[model samples]
Target: MNTITDTSIESITIEAADPDATREFLAAAFGLGGRIRVRRSEAPTTGFRGFTVSLIVAQPSTVHSLVGTALAAGAVEIKPVAKSMWGVGGTVQAPDGTVWKVATSAKKDTGPATREVEKVVILLGAEDVGASKRFYLDRGFTVDKSFGSYVEFETPGSPIGLGLYRRRALAKDAGVDESGSGSHRVVISGPAGTDPDGFAWEPNPSEQ
Candidate 1:
């Protein structure tokens, strides 16, 4: 089914048990530039929520800065920051059960650590990458790249970009197990609906 295809990602709502504390953590840790929101929800959820929010920054310093702050804010380190063929990055799981990955394409430090974030990509774990890609295409999203088990959608000017990855692969990448049930405990505000993989969304409050 065609979910939110042509929509712009205004923000993401992280359904949290303690909204106040979670909000504070996100603000102090990632400072995602107002791209994240939180609401109280006791919905049963466990393991990997089948999604992860990524902080795509410009330099390695920024990666260290963001990940360091996240760790200091009580986020558990899932993967240590280090350089790889794809650049330097690492993963962490927030106290609220949300997985976050901080990464940069630059291997070398560019000047000093800055709070500047180049982009944020919401990666949804998909059962079938091709099927999900078609769903988005039918709805209206243009493909930036689609190869093997990954598909990235072009979302120019949007606060958050979208991508699809195999569920198991996504969980492995986040250093978690692909075993989650109950509500995802997260909502994509701009899309305002549920996708094929049971990923949920809600209308952008600003648009409403």
Candidate 2:
């Protein structure tokens, strides 16, 4: 197995019908740095192809506030803020139709655990979970957990966690339509450059 040397998710690129609007919405909601890249697509995209970008905050209190901020910034509520066994979380759809899940752990912790924006998790819905998992595993992502329909990978030294899920199930969880085609509308970057699963990283001058 090839061990991936660099695990950090340097940035995410998105293809959108209105790149500027999507970029503005994301910036306003998450206060993203230059890490997010957006490009305008000549045609409309369809399908449950896009990935879910999760922001894990240190404080549970920040969850609701962040959800509200996203709503005010033109994100439609997909799942309302609620506490579950896992933690507090809510789902929303950005103006460009990207799904986002904002959450934090339910259990209280000490010290730095109370900080905001604990980590960013990228969950890609795959047409074939097993194949996708194998693709990532071959590229050096350690298996964190796995089940029949889902598998998560640990990106060491990275504030990002990557996962693969069944496309239809993911769409259902996000309260969105499972029928979409065209562009996946997502990009992931790391030191490895690209993966067998078809995610690629483009050179960013800002990061150089």
Candidate 3:
């Protein structure tokens, strides 16, 4: 799949220890509309998973609403909703151990709270951000933006967005220690197979 051109992650399949509970939690909390799939797996995963799925929305109210629903749906709050230099957001660990970031760029409420998600971003924590960025580019992923330690891929029309950041920095952003061993416990679809950073990928089922 090295020649993959004009690509985006169609969806991600999370290998859950408790598929049923995880599915229910996801449905009630974020209503991912099946973009997040689950299957049973006992793979050992601890601490940070080297990745996070971020929900970017239009306003702070949506962030509050989403975070509140996530907590009510059995997610453990990793960070309380608060304003940051970037905007407003928070973190939560799903019942199945997936770290999720709910965020918005707007500082104030645009209107009433609504469960609307503007984008679903999958950010991979890469050991060598520059190398990984180059790897993805060689695989035909368009660069939306890039800086010293971060790269965002152009994923137009994709249900799941893609980006890469320095591993240590990513952990800091997630408010977690950067020490963890074992599987990431998830597989995504963009370019099939694993990348240099060990992020797993499979053929997008939707394209089958």
CA lDDT scores, all candidates in order: 0.87, 0.75, 0.87
TM-score of each: 0.96, 0.83, 0.95
Candidate 2 minimal-lDDT segment of 10 residues: 107-116
Instruction: Quantify how close model 1 is to the true structure by its C-alpha RMSD in Å.
Output: 1.3
On residues 1-208, what C-alpha lDDT tens digit does candidate 2 reach at each position?
A: 3234455666777778888898889777887666567888765577566478888887666777778889999999989988778878899988887889988886454444322577788888888888877776666678988988988887777556788888888888787888877667776666445444455554433456
- Over 114-170, each residue of candidate 1 has an lDDT whose tens digit, in order, gives 978888899999998888778778778898988889889998889999999999999
The number of clashing residue pairs in each candidate reads: 1, 4, 0
lDDT of 3 by residue, 43-149 (tens): 89888889989999999999999999999999999999999999999999988878899999899987888899999999999998878887888888888988888
Model 2 backbone overlap count: 4
- The alpha-carbon lDDT assigned to residue 44 of candidate 1 equals 89
TM-score ranking of the models: 1, 3, 2
Q: TM-score of the candidate numbered 1?
A: 0.96
- Model 3 clash pairs? none
